[model samples]
Target: MRLSDGPVALRPLRMRDAQPWHDLRRENHTWLKPWEATRPVDETPEMSFANMVRRLRAEARAGRTMPFAITWSGTFIGQLTVSGITWGSLCGGHIGYWIDKGHAGRGVMPTAVALATDHALQTMGLHRVEICIRPENANSRRVVEKLGFREEGLRPAYLHIDGEWRDHLVYVITSEEIPGGLLNRWRATHGPLHA
Candidate 1:
């Protein structure tokens, strides 16, 4: 499935995206390093792009994840994924994303995130969606703030980022809170974008 509004779009990540994805990661190494998750030192080696795509696809098929490639003006720019979906009573998922440094502050990330969150709530039948942002990640925090997600609390050493565990500010929004939908709320609050 694909989700989009204005110039920002999110679609399933493809194997063909490997080269651009790798290049973007390389270019944004310094920009993204601090927020990127790191595996345990003793874990198995990192998987290749193809393997990663296969794994994500399998997860998507299992209804456990939604792996999407973020694009702006028809150009690939980043990635956003709604992962760790739980259905029993929780019926929620967590969102994680990264964008090229050049695309920051232009509303691209927020728009992409809003689209994904709305999809999770509406199409995926999820009740809640969570976004965990490192306390120091002002840009990411802004995305949630812009969407009016309530700050639940702080998670100490929540996830291993860069090289060590980091504290994250937990933000959450339930479907009932966004009855009009996240994209609609964003557009109403921020006005329509030219891009």
Candidate 2:
């Protein structure tokens, strides 16, 4: 399911993506480390490509989770994942994503998110989606805000990262609020968002 706005496409994550994923992550380690889960030195060895492939494939085989590698033309740029999916009365999940430092501000995550959210709602019949971002991560908060997810409130000690508990701002969106969906709302409103 590629969502195109020119030439870029947000597609599914592939097993072979391990190499590019590793390369990009390693290159952005300094930029990504603060917000990402801190791993043991051994856990983040520069040569754990096999582990990435195996884990990603196994996770994809399970029905409740979906992850994608953001791409442009033919380059793997980053990752986006929607996990903890629930059914029945609560069709919801949590979203986590990161953009390659080179791709951070070029609409990659936003488009990836729009396409992924469509899958959550239309394909999986989900009702809502949530994202909790560190209070200091203004850029991440902007991404959720651009998608129109309301601020749900503060969650003190919400995420475990950098080997410590941290606070986060909860943001959420429901199917009904999207007006058929994000692309539709954008088409109706004309252009993307800011702030």
Provide C-alpha RMSD values for all models, in order.
1.0, 3.5
- The window of 10 residues in a row where model 2 has the poorest summed lDDT is 186-195
lDDT of 2 by residue, 75-113 (tens): 888878888888879989888988888778766677667
Deviation of model 1 at 116, angstroms: 0.6
TM-score of 2: 0.85
Q: Estimate candidate 1's alpha-carbon lDDT, on a 0 to 1 scale.
A: 0.92
**Candidate 1 lDDT by residue in tens digits, 54-110:** 999999999999999999877899999999999999999999999999999988888
Q: Which one is best on TM-score?
A: 1
TM-score of each: 0.97, 0.85
